[model samples]
Target: MSNSMKVSFCCKDCKRKMFDYYAGILNLYIKCNRCKRVLTLKKIDEKYVAERMINGKLFV
Candidate 1:
């Protein structure tokens, strides 16, 4: 069987669901439809983590 898993998360500013993502999938950047905020995905400690990006600054 495949080892990949599904990942789902919400927007930090709007608290709305962004989209569904697969575990092995890597998206450099994602934009929230509601708030129009940009998010960056980074792999930390072997797991994918999301962080907010504004004006070229990274916010946790």
Candidate 2:
């Protein structure tokens, strides 16, 4: 079986959850649906994904 896990992303500005389900961690850029802010999927730990928000802040 693959090790990729399904996870959801939340917009830091609006705190709104995105609609799509992403599998595995990606060091890529994504836009927030609500705030239209660009963010990076920074890392994926054992159980959660960490995201970098528009304010240069990290959130889990």
List runs of model 2 lying over 4 Å from the truth: 1-7, 19-23, 47-60
| Best model per lDDT | 1
lDDT of 2 at 15: 71
Candidate 2: worst 10 consecutive residues by lDDT?
49-58
Q: Name every residue pair that clashes in candidate 1.
A: none
What root-mean-square deviation over C-alphas does model 2 reach? Answer: 7.0
Residue-level lDDT tens digits of model 2 in 1-60: 124534455665787765434445556687776678887666554344334333323332
Model 1: runs farther than 4 Å from truth? 1-5, 44-60
Estimated TM-score for each candidate: 0.51, 0.45
